[model samples]
Target: MPVTTELILARHGEAHCNVAGIVGGEATCTGLTDQGHAQVRRLAVRLDQEHTTAPMSALYTSPRRRTVDTAAHLADQLNLETRVEPALRGLDHGEADGRPWTAIKRRFGGRPQQYPHRPIAAGAETWNAFISRCRAVLRRILDKHEGERVLIAAHGETIEASFALFLPLPLDDTELAGQITGHSCLTRWQRHRNTFGHDVWMLAGHNDTNHLRSPMEVIT
Candidate 1:
């Protein structure tokens, strides 16, 4: 009997760059803002409650300040250690790091998602390249923890890439098709072996932000 593998993906909370409308690459990312921390804390509480039903075997985070900070809250809440995965990081903004989106659009001609092969700027990762990297890392993680529940704290783009990998969504139309993931939102997928002995993945959940709803959820 093949057991199911549960993979839960969590988007990082809002950062200063998010509010500032600037690219938040590793070079420029400081960490989560105060409201960001509060958001992650709410998520942490929810994950803690869910842990009783489905205990997480492992926790991973993208190698960015915002993601790491988000994972830190979950780690502390669940008493789990986190493994930083560089491949799980968001698209490389390269020269656009810390730069305003308007400036980047003027310099790079458009957003990185507009072209699959063309990078947003010199040294940046192309949209296609990012999807490939995310798929590879997701495969490695799934294989490493075949039957266990694993959690990942990463960026919204990383979550979008996951959808591209599992759902086989068109790379160009993923975000353009109005598939924007929310901050501190949770998405889940399950891998199971079918009767034909083939592995199939199911989208268990997407953009679940029940944790954010307190007395009243503040729209960011």
Candidate 2:
């Protein structure tokens, strides 16, 4: 049976901090770059065209500037109001929040994923705690919006979390567990009942960036 309950996750476009090689936590994020805006506009057009056939029921976004900006473009295209979910925000970087990745690496000796059990920085979120919140937020979304096609404009890590939860993949704290989600890429999942009547979430697509492949644009 076809599943009408769909969940689409879109990673926010490139931000200034991304170009500057800094961690874009809530305290440091400055929103999307012009190129990022262009990338998302293309995605919005694609979604708008697809909406004629499979309209989305709701749109959600994290409170970060980059995510909010990405959601704004999507909202305009889909004619849907953007609902902000604090739980959907990216990992809390704590003391590393506005610091350069290079500097942080020099201090911490490796990436945050390298030390999953510990904080990336003072007052930061641990890998375990972060994945737990991600799972909880996704569960809440599925329960509240069952049978409806829902979209979320969120961070790359949030999208990663969805894959971990819905696909029943291990939340690997020691390293990058799955493919890194690209900027403004779309990942889709559909929930359906299996032969035993157990609910299952099937991956429809992952890291889809077809809309950004125009001749005028260069994916970087």
For each candidate, C-alpha RMSD in Å? 3.4, 2.9
Q: Over the stretch 1-220, how does candidate 2's per-residue lDDT look in tens digits?
A: 5685999999988889999999888998999999899899889888877779879999999999999999999998789999999999988889999999999877876876677788878999987688789889988987899889999998888887887787676756477555768899999999877777777788889899988885443222
Clashing pairs in 1: none
- Cα error, residue 130 of model 2, in Å, equals 0.9
State the weakest 10-residue window (summed lDDT) of model 2.
Answer: 211-220
Residue 128 C-alpha lDDT in model 2: 69
What ranges in model 2 sit over 4 Å off? 171-173, 194-198, 214-220
Measure candidate 2: CA RMSD: 2.9
Best by TM-score: 2
Alpha-carbon lDDT of model 2: 0.86
TM-score of each: 0.90, 0.92
Quantify all predictions' global Cα lDDT against the true fold. 0.86, 0.86
